[model samples]
Target: MNKIYILLGTNLGDRFQQLNLARKQLETHVGAIIEASSIYETAAWGVEDQPAFLNQVVLVTSELQPLACLNLTQHIEQELGRIRFKKWGERVIDIDLLYFNQEIIDLPSLQIPHPYIAERRFTLEPLVEIAPGYIHPVYKKNNVYLLDKCTDDLPVKKISDDEPYRH
Candidate 1:
């Protein structure tokens, strides 16, 4: 099985419920989830006028390839009521394929290593919680190191201390 790290966020409708539904869809279509981080609430990036987003990271084991996984995630997003009105626009759910087994990919349809891992505290925080030692193939840095080096000024607040990633 190929190990994949996914970052999930939602800012519209039932945010937490949307995240949970995405998790279920990921397990069904992509692979079984092995680990996830506690949810974090963060101010909107790109477009600052939008509402805050709830974010988390999940580690899964899947047999699907990179593009195939991307296809599945987009399908899940649409099924869950995502509409691309603008770049970084508000949405019901935003699922990002952060890393796929340490591979580096830059395709027109998808980009691995997420292109913004080093700059987004919302992505690095939850990622560090679950996989601090998982090295980035390109940067050759671990998740904890990346989190410490992140310079994104946006606040990423943990929803609660006791909450687990799983529903």
Candidate 2:
């Protein structure tokens, strides 16, 4: 099984429910989830005019390859009502593949060890909560170090302290 880190974010139409539904879809299509971070609420990144987002990071073990994982994530997003109206536009669900077993992959369609992981507090905060020691493939830094060095300045506040989901 390949270990993957996935970031979930939603800003529209019952944000929490969107996250729950996305988790269910991921479990069915991607793989079993081994760990998950508590939910965090943050101001919109990139586009600032939209509603705040609820975000979380989940660690999953899957048999799918990188490209296949990316495809499944996009499929889940669409099935959950995502429409690409604009770059960084508001969405009902956004599933980002952050890392695929510490591998560095550079394809025209996907980039692993997500390019923005270090720069976004919303991503880093939840990541640190679950995988502080998981080193980044390119940056060679642990999530906690990345979170400390992050300069995004955007406040990423944990909205829930629930235990990591396991099944």
Candidate 3:
């Protein structure tokens, strides 16, 4: 099984419910979830005028290749009511393939070790929680190290006692 790390976020309409549904969809289309980070409440990135987002990082062990995983993630996003409008626009659900094992890929449509992984606090915070020691192939740094150096000042608060959507 290939280890994949996925970052999930939602800012529109029942954010927690959206996240839960996304997780369920991931399990169905991707692979069994090995681990999941706590849900984090954070300010919007890129498009700052919208509502804050609830975000989390999930680790999955799958047999699918990177491109196949990407396609599946897009399908799940669309199924969850995502409509593309702007770069980083608010949506019902957004799922990004953050990393796939230690593969370093750069293609027209996909980039593993996600190009922006080091820049966003929301991604790093949850990523660190689950995979603190996992090293970035390009940066040669661990998630904890990257999180420490991250300049984005977005506040990420973990929500306790909250459950993700089941279906």
Candidate 4:
């Protein structure tokens, strides 16, 4: 089995339900979910005019290879009502493959370690919550360190566990 980190974000529709449905589909298609970070609410990244986004990171153990993981994630996004009308546009759900067993891959279709890991507060905040000491393969710095050094000034507030979907 391979351990992979995935980021789930949603800003359209019932955000909580979208996340819950995405998680269920991911577990069914990707693998068993081992760890998940608390949900976070943050201003829209890249495009600021859209609704605030709810984001979370999950660690899963999967038998699928890296590319297969990417394909399934995209499929899940589409099934959940994602339409790629514009870059960084609002979506019902977004699933991103962040890390795949600490391996670095640079294919046109995918890039492991997610090229933007260190640059986005939304990604780093949840990463620090779940895997603070996990090292970035290319940056050689742990998640906590990357989060501290992250220059993205966006505020990432962790949602209270009082939510119905706290997973």
Candidate 5:
């Protein structure tokens, strides 16, 4: 089984609930979720006018290939009422394939070690929590290095008093 890292976020209704639903669906479609990072509340990226998002990273072991995983993630997003109206627009849920066993891929439908992995602090912060030493195949940098290089100044705070999916 290949270990894959997936990042999930939500800014719409019951954000925490949406994230939990995504995680549950992912476990069914993909494989066992080996690790999960603490949830972080962050300002929306790209579509900066939207609401802040609740984000988290999950490390999973799966038998599916990268494309398959991507497809599965999209399915879950759609099921959770995600609508791709604008780039990074607020949504019910967003699931992104962040990395797949240090593999480099650039295809029309998918990219491993997601192209924007180094640019988003929301993604990197949780990634550092779960897999700080995992290397990025293309950049050859670990999570720590990537976090250090990220230029996004969006604040990320861990909700210490809340449960993973409790709103």
Candidate 6:
């Protein structure tokens, strides 16, 4: 089984509910959930004019390969009403394959070690929470190193402790 790390974000209706729904959907399509980070509320990263987003990171163990995982995630996003209107536009839910078993994937449609991982605090904060010592295959650095090197001045705050991580 491959240890996959996924990031979920939402800024649309019922943000918390959307996150929960995304988690459930991922568990169904991607694989069983192993670990999840607390929800982080963060300012819009690329397009600053939009609403703040709620983000979370999760670790899952899956038997599917990289492209199959990406296909399923995109399918889930569309099923939940995601329209790609802008580069970093607000959406009902966003699912990103952050890492795939310390493997590097750079296909046109999918990019593992999510290219922006080291640049966004929102992604890094929750990642650091659950997998601080996990190394990035491309950078050869751990989550802690990426968090420390992140230059995205945007604020990432943990808004919910009411919920525990997923199993």
**Over the full model, what C-alpha lDDT does candidate 3 score relative to the true structure?**
0.91
The ten-residue window of minimal lDDT in model 6 covers: 158-167
Give a tens-digit lDDT track for model 6, residues 13-117: 999989889989988888999999999999998999999999999999999999999999999999999999989999999999999997887789888879999
Global lDDT of each model?
0.93, 0.93, 0.91, 0.91, 0.88, 0.92
Off by over 4 Å in 3: 161-167
Worst 10-residue lDDT window for candidate 1 reads: 158-167
Q: Per-residue lDDT of 73-145 in model 2, one digit per residue for the tens?
A: 9999999999999988899999999999979999899998798999999999999999989999898889999
Model 2 Cα shift for residue 89 (angstroms): 1.4
Candidate 4 TM-score to native: 0.96
C-alpha lDDT (0 to 100) for residue 14 of candidate 3: 95
lDDT of 4 by residue, 8-105 (tens): 99999999999999999999999998888889998899988999999999999999999999999999999999999888889999999999998999
Question: How does candidate 3 fare on TM-score?
Answer: 0.95
Clashing pairs in 3: 20-165
Q: Return the clash pairs for model 6, or none.
A: none
Q: What is the TM-score (0 to 1) of candidate 6?
A: 0.97
Clashes of 5: 0
Residue 97 of model 3, lDDT score: 91
Model 2: how far is 46 from its true place, Å? 0.6
Clashes within 3 Å, all models in order: 0, 0, 1, 0, 0, 0
lDDT of 5 by residue, 1-167 (tens): 99989999999999888988998999899988888889999999888998999999998899999988888989989988999998889899999998898788989888786889899999999899889999888887798998998899989888732443321
Residue 162 lDDT in candidate 5: 46
Error of 3 at 38 (Å): 0.4
The C-alpha RMSD in Å for every predicted model, in order, reads 1.2, 0.9, 2.1, 1.6, 2.4, 0.8
Runs in model 4 deviating more than 4 A are: 162-167
Local lDDT at 135 for model 5:
83
Order of quality (lDDT): 2, 1, 6, 4, 3, 5
